[model samples]
Target: MSSYVEGALVEGERIVHAGRISAWALWHLIGLGIILLPAFGIGLVFLIIAYVRYQSTELAVTTKRVIVKHGFIRRQTVEINLSKVESIQVDQGVLGRMLNFGTLIVAGTGTSHAPLAGIADPMAFRKAFIEAQDEGQEGI
Candidate 1:
């Protein structure tokens, strides 16, 4: 759990699920490693980029809202109330479907859609969000 995410939680808001960055995001690093096998130093840069991306990005579904954070130095955060969430659209290509990783597009009441790519177990994340949303609606 990242401090940025923990600090963003409101009163009584508990995390229902925490989505992870998919291993698929490291594909670029793998390819670079192979191509730059002789020059290991260059390959290391790509590996670091993948690691930073995987570690800095955070996704969580809470009792009150859904939260997403990206980047390390220049941060970007998105929060949508459960009541305002219209739907979660998932995009999984053949490779993604086989590897069980995909993109999750969270559409709010308006025209805004937050598309998170290279997420692990996106379906499970979506299910957890929907369940939380349903429970919140029932409690209202």
Candidate 2:
């Protein structure tokens, strides 16, 4: 869990599902690094960038809200209450489908959609959100 997500949680909130950027998403950088490693140390920079990107992003469905954060210094965060979430849309390409990683678009009532790219197991994230939403409604 990222510090932002942990800090954003309120009383009684618990994470139901945590999402991550798939290693597959970093293939290009990894490949570039490997290909350039023999030429110079520049390849190390690509690998480091990929590692930083993987570590800096976080996504989760919680009892109260869905949260997503990206970046370490210049941060971007999104939160949508369970009751206000209109939809969770997943977009998968051929490779993504085979690898079980995709993009997630979270739509909240009266709010612009938040698109999270390169998320692993996006369907599971959507399922967790749906279950949480249902449970929250039952408690109301």
Candidate 3:
């Protein structure tokens, strides 16, 4: 099977985060469940946004680079090269730790945009990603 991978920059890195389409439900769970808006009309507008985010989140890492693609109708993509990466860190909350899901922070050597954001399985990914970055630099 083949998936349309967005143009990215990664090398020997496992997917740190790839959100499921079901993330839409999370918005409602928050906007509606927690906020408990009396009128569903205005708040519903933001709900649509949350739904879109639920659908848009797609963070991945491959053998070449880091890829971030989001947005529903209009899509936005960001790619970061491993060599430009200055450091990698894993962030986990109580829930994220138990679920094997957390955010991966990629610190760039130069610009912050060079880093990938909000990726899952940050701990495992950082190790492999750093190794790949080292290898790539060593090669050059």
Regions of candidate 1 where Cα sits further than 4 Å from its true position = none
lDDT of 2 at 85: 86
lDDT of 2 by residue, 10-49 (tens): 9999989988999898899988988887777888888888
Clashing residue pairs in candidate 3 (N, C-alpha, C atoms within 3 angstroms): 9-65, 9-66, 10-64, 10-65, 11-63, 11-64, 11-65, 12-63, 16-120, 17-120
lDDT of all predictions: 0.90, 0.90, 0.58
Report the C-alpha lDDT of model 1 over 13-132, residue by residue, as the tens digit.
999999998978578786786577669478777777778888899999999999999998999999999999998999999999999899999999989899999999999999999999
Encode model 3's per-residue lDDT on 5-107: one tens digit a residue: 5334335445543433334225444566446445656666666676667657676555456666767778877667766667767667786676555666677
lDDT of 1 at 75: 97
Q: Which number leads on lDDT?
A: 2
Of candidate 3, the 10-residue stretch with the lowest lDDT total is 16-25
Clashes of 2: 0
Ranking the candidates on lDDT from highest down gives 2, 1, 3
How do all models score by TM-score? 0.94, 0.94, 0.59
Residue range with the least summed lDDT across 10 consecutive positions in model 2: 1-10
